[model samples]
Target chain A: MMNSPICSMLDIEFPLLAFSHCRDVVAAVSKAGGMGVFGAVNLSPERLREELDWIDAHADGKPYGVDLIVPNKFAGKGEKLDTGRLIDSIPQEHKDFASGILAEHDIATDELDRTRGISGNFARNLRAEGAASSLEVAFEYPIKLIANALGVPPQVMLDLGKQHGVPVAALVGAKEHAVAQVNAGVDILVVAGGEAGGHCGDVSTMVLIPEVARALKEVGADTPILAAGGITTGEQMAAAIAMGAAGAWCGSVWLTTAEAETNPVVKEKMLAASSRDTVRSRSRTGKPSRQLRSPWTDAWEGEDAPEPLPMPLQSMVSEPALRQIDKLSQSGHQGAKDLATYWVGQGVGLMNQPLSSGQVVQQFKEEFAEAFERLSASLGD
Target chain B: MMNSPICSMLDIEFPLLAFSHCRDVVAAVSKAGGMGVFGAVNLSPERLREELDWIDAHADGKPYGVDLIVPNKFAGKGEKLDTGRLIDSIPQEHKDFASGILAEHDIATDELDRTRGISGNFARNLRAEGAASSLEVAFEYPIKLIANALGVPPQVMLDLGKQHGVPVAALVGAKEHAVAQVNAGVDILVVAGGEAGGHCGDVSTMVLIPEVARALKEVGADTPILAAGGITTGEQMAAAIAMGAAGAWCGSVWLTTAEAETNPVVKEKMLAASSRDTVRSRSRTGKPSRQLRSPWTDAWEGEDAPEPLPMPLQSMVSEPALRQIDKLSQSGHQGAKDLATYWVGQGVGLMNQPLSSGQVVQQFKEEFAEAFERLSASLGD
Candidate 1:
């Protein structure tokens, strides 16, 4: 039933919103009738433009959104180091540690050359400028909503969304943070629990959803709360709505979909994985991102291995090695496969079959409706 | 640092008490001057006598406890079913599903021999009788405390503990549950969060600890709280104490210790595992237990596999398969190795090397002292 305020506000068939880094998944979900928020963290200006343009042409005028990762604790306002300088300031010990592990695994050390200067996900320099560019590109298309992934949306992003007559959403891990986002003029709150993929804080969705939603209401805020993390099936989506959330926001489920741009080798691992297969480790992005546990993460976990550098510094140090791991894994190197990892959520265990993103959306709708009927039937029973 | 009144009240060096099923780990922790709570879920009366006798002999006359898994939920409230009757009642479809998966993995189907009787870490009976023998055996020992692993200690257990001049404890996963247990005459509240091994409710330690401790204080309940779950190092113990917990209780850390009767093959995996390597799955014992993901879990997650049976029923259906998997895994069967799983916690990732149980306790004490000093230094800075 579209009785949930989030579903009514978004005018969707169900209260499930899928977040994905792949444009194809976004387009498929939007076309299939649930809102899809495309993660634009790693996309270049041109690549983002091409993606939005494609969505605009194919979405059948359906509502969709864009997501950016702008955290409150970014290399904050002090003497700010530029990307190149930050890269240089990383300790040689951390670099040596990463390379040494790669060497110990018998991976070609020479492949490290190809990984140099590779800018992975997240903005490394002048993130505000990049966020503005992404906002501009998204607005040029008919985007209905925008989200800041890691923390509160910037005042500029909020103002831009307001000017464009679109909703500005913020991803938050705590109730206090949700209140802050609402105070800062966010239109929607995406409450992601620790069971989520990518960046998350330690709170489970079953508890966090109602807590954040209740906090928003108590504070005289009506910002629709979209419960994120660990939501994989339609029943879970129904449960989220039942738990006072306007909708369920999902990401990891998309990685197993046919439209996902996940590495083929890693995708195979994910397909073979259960929801129990994921771990929250900083080895990938230098934040507590839930990912598939591969030997790469195990190597960093050893006592002798240097402690992971913080945030961007750790990401910068490990990205080169990870890129190489991906390349070698793709080529079917046994050692590299052992070292390869991909970001995912605890919901991975529930995802046993590969479905098209559209099929996923459709199944979610069917399941949501079935669950609603089951709940209703219990009253009579 | 050990001057907390709860410590003296509980007759322990620190209020922190690790709850586990292994007698060796329990004795080791008690010998190290902290308390150890032995989980008695799987022990028969004779076996438990031997364990308590061993603990009494080796614990150096220090305070220790016994923990029994008496989940508030169970099957057959009015009448008890015989083992043959319960086994016969298991849906053939579930048995077929288990057989098919084992067949696919090339694990011997003969290992499902029904004549061998029920197997696993708990008795097959779904009645309170399942844990009764263990509880009776525990009362024979001079335990300093008696705890219920899954819920509030039964009134009989509390009465028994009171009769023996020992404290009764109950494990709670939520703050609300803690408040309820405190009102129910529990002298000590074992707060186990989602990151803990075995059955854990969905709440992170960081939030759950403060919430429960604060709630207890607000209500004027003097129930001593032992923070369990993901606590591994002494620093975490300090952090829990800082959050108003008397001390920290641990399980996963002991699983990697030399004195632990942990599955040797599984211990090897735990040695290399990180905090992220574990998953909360109901594949074991029919409740959500944090366990390492193996191919057996993955097999059950597949499309054709029946959804894991609920609680005791599921545990009943799967334990036979798991026991066989463990045996094959020990024999170096590649398929079974992939399928073998173990109960663990997020703390597994932090254990870089195996140490004697005594040495592990020593490190915890040393680390705890250092962490406090670090915090105290930060205060001056």
Candidate 2:
């Protein structure tokens, strides 16, 4: 039954929350017992509107949420720059580094200059000002929750959440951040550990969970925590719940699922690779992020590599190059395939099989019950 | 009863294993419900024998274990270097770097040179050839378990365990290491994650436990796993067990306990530290290990810092300096106190109080029950 406060708060059967960029995954996971949160970082206001509209149709009267990157602080936050200006502001050396990596891999670089114009707009939307339009579009839909990552939920998001009567969640990788989010009137804390797929801090979920839980108690805040990191199996979900997390918030486990829009080559790499294959480097986002290791990441980590530029700029440089890599790899380019990588957690080692989102949810339930039964046996005797 | 296969195998009521360097802590925890495994790294053969003799007299018929650093590979594995020969082999620059840091703290570095003579023997003893006498001394006692870290239990230790009817356990940080340990016939795997104190791998316990458990299953091994990392609470212990561990192996949780031989100044620092206060660096040991963040660790991680020497050599350089830091800090040297640090996991945040070892074991039982009740309530409906 997994009757957590979060389950009731979100009006979902299970407390499990799946975060994915693909609308199909969000709809499918929500249609299962778990709630799905669509990551709308790169999605434009119009694009988010379209994705949510699709989710509304496919979600089968189930609740879903939206996640955005309205960080409390970032590079070029206050400045108003058009997509072209933002792309132009990126260092020439950084652009050359990105293009050179692709060139060395024998892939096309022509599409990167184009991808910037598109991804550039999304990168600008990462600020509260830019994200406001997207959130306004999201509020028009029936989103059960709204979340912010990389920092505390901005005041605009908080005020908007209050006005709409929707819970506001913030992702935190450390105990202090969790306390800050709770103080900022965030309703839910996505206490992610260092092993989480995208942006993350250095602390692990095992330590961070209890640390956040205790800090909340000390601060007299009762904010429910959703443990996120290398959670793949139902037992891990159960383990998180046991360690003071109200539920489990999983992202990487779904990337290998059948409903995921994950690049096929990268998915295959994840299936074959050990947990050691992922590197937490700032090359992609100018902030530490866990991703599958490939020649691209290796080159960035190499001694001769240039320092990654800050936030949106790093994303601007990387997203375009990676998008083309995905395209070429899918089109049967061996060099592109060799250089392909994707955001994933250490849990990639456990996600060996490709299941549907529904099947994954079902397994989580069954495995969860089995884990309890195992615990009961050991504890009972 | 917190009974599992490990409990029955180790003849303890609870599966919680307290790892400490102090003989009193080992005896006190063994006297309680949990088994304490003494860290036997720096203890000389005669010193370890005397410590075990004290534990035997005070353990009140409870089980205890001994842990040594018998790496499968190291810098001076086959070398026949005595204490003086080993001390002379350390690079002058590294010695200067460590001592210079102490001098900058306005603390005396005079004792460092003398401490190295003693620590040099311990560093040399980390390899199999030098550890043979220590193991022979330990075998003379009524120890229930024998364990090794940094690598697989050496062939000599494994053979000795087979002959002596003692279970040989090995500490591993990754799934591959766990499989290798099982193949090497290690009866128990202390799966210490990156968040653990002392020598560790980069994988967190939450990820490593399930990963190692699955790997062991694939290899058809039924070795019991003691999950070690940022485990400081009963709920975390339960979570470890829920995530396929037999029990929890904790070290940092005890450093703040009343019985711990932790330096007084350092204990206060740990009590006040946040989970983020620990730094995982290769400054102290040749390999990466988590320790409290201080000016000492800060200097090593700085841009101008020299590369840490390999395994026994790094230990030779840092140990002597740190030992003097501890002494000066204890004598009320503010600068020394500011620069003082010791090995501790990220779980230090939860260890705020100075409870006795017995009280800690009792709280763990109560906490375990409460954690289970919490899990049951969530799943009961």
Candidate 3:
């Protein structure tokens, strides 16, 4: 295997970093020689502990990591608002708008009423106190790295990473963000472009990766960067490595994998989608996240539609409705099926079939080799 | 020098195709051993002939090409509407909204009134008959290639290209589009992503280039692909080539070159801007085109703003006001300076300095060499 610095640092055969919320996909990828990093934002402390314990049992002695949502700012941030206070803060108008949309699709509003007071996991985990508890549980396991998704890793998180001898990573969408992360002592930079599945900036991967790489080198920072966004194939990983990324950090590609926890309806939709099917809308998480374009997104973008609320508040309004949609869509509800969508990159167009996580790892290995050969062939004598 | 099929086909020293509207940039880039393609959408047949004559006089025996906007679908496309009819068809509300915006900036509305009768070159040339005139003028010169910006090249264009021993290229945003073009007998594919200047689709270059290449290969098509979108530097060029592109087709990077006709105020803003400074808005072109985000775009995106009219109609509304803004901004008008924006890609963030066209090409060569060396070194024994 072609070795990169990140491969040695993370103790993986390849530098590919698979980001997934499902424990099975994570363990399968790790066991297949690529390091799997479990996304822990939606998990409670007890649930995270249980998941990590399971990974520890089945990871086959391969090093794996964890990702957390520790943003610098969120609703009820510095004021330290509890879950109940946060739920109480949501406006009735926003709730009504959510229920109205579901009711239009013939979905019962009773489920939303029951879940209204339960609060959302994203809202709960994004706050300072909530993220701290998750971080505490994460460090108890042997994580090779820990990543912060929304912004620069907090000082406490950085300090904890240092104490545990684990490298800290942060995702950046621009060159200036990469510089700030490096200055903040981040060990790795996940340079994601706008074409990435979740929250992203407007820059595309082709430009952002090399721009960040050059900026880091100009500042004399030796931090390794993992290129993300619209990179599903091994050929793309090879291209990113050629652009100065130490490895490929993938997220959306795993959503269609056989062992993934992705809703089967959404998975099928993703399998049949083209790159243009995704739109970067603030409807999902109150941030611009790329998700499949559906009647739901179209309605949010319509003339009379209310502007989506910010961050956790928007997630609060969207999650319950979407959860119900997924449940009904699986049972063949036409309206729910039409409105069902999920967060995915433009690479979803290329993901036409379902493969086991291990099979994806093997395919990545073979494609990486072929891409290297192609590059070598291009350098003619 | 490294050679690809496109390099030999175009008889250029490098596989870099510089797309520009300025005659000076075209001649200079061609003289510097790279293929320079003149963007002919904004010029009349007589003006195109004049520009091509200028390029022919100064190109020093080097070959160049021309790009035209001949989309399959446009306003008044199949109806054969005259300029007066098309202008008369625009809604009064849109015209009033556009005029009010300029009036708020303290610019005189007289220039707009005078130009109201004159149809925009974009609106004119996008029609079949107008494009035919432009093509006739283009073929009078020693052009090596003719490209369609928004869709498949018309049958007449393909036939003319074959008769003249020149290649016909079409820019596409998706692999499906590439397949359609190949099936339509397009000689070359310019696979551009959402980050490209002018008109572009939602796919990022990193995914689109490889996807198109693989799709073409699967279908046994030998069409060469030129990767575009947010590709400003030679390192990015190397990355694209590694991803399966035969060459790099660049546009935004040339706008900041010394010979470019970009408005001075907007050029300064582009130099100081980051990737996030640009937004894809339909306010200017009636299509989703990426340009610098200014008060003008923000106002159009506001709640009270009318939905932007389609293509030529929106261009009709915006062109007059923007022309006045650009002219006034150059003369120290603060409001005009604030409102002045231009079509550019996210690559503007990396363009920090103004270099002559020859200098830019020389830098591309040096950067391309360094990137190749870096890739070679990574494949260690």
Instruction: Give the candidate number with the greatest DockQ.
Output: 2
- What DockQ results do all the predictions give, each relative to the true complex? 0.02, 0.69, 0.61
Q: After superposition, how far is residue B212 of candidate 1 from its true place, in Å?
A: 27
lDDT of each: 0.73, 0.86, 0.85
* Candidate 1 per-residue lDDT over residues A194-220, each given as its tens digit: 878877876566446655765676788
The true-versus-predicted C-alpha distance at residue A291 of model 1, in Å, is: 1.0
Lowest summed lDDT window (length 10), candidate 1 chain B: B372-381
Per-chain TM-score, chain A, candidate 1? 0.93
Better structure of 1 and 2 per DockQ = 2
Worst 10 residues of 2 chain A by lDDT: A112-121
- Model 1 misplaced stretches (Cα beyond 4 Å): A76-83, A113-126, B1-67, B70-381
lDDT of 3 by residue, B1-381 (tens): 355878878888888899998989999999998889999988989899999999999999899999998888767776655767667878888877777877788877876752443356665787788888899999999999899987888888998999999999899988888999999988889999889887778788888887888889889998999999998888788788877888899988888888998998998999888877888889887899988888888889887788888766787788778888888999999889999999998888788888998998999888776776666665555
Best by TM-score: 2
The residue ranges of model 3 lying beyond 4 angstroms of the native Cα positions read A78-93, A113-124, B78-89, B114-124
TM-score of chain A of each: 0.93, 0.95, 0.95
Interface RMSD of each: 19.3, 1.4, 1.9
lDDT score, residue A367, model 1? 61
Better structure of 1 and 2 per TM-score: 2
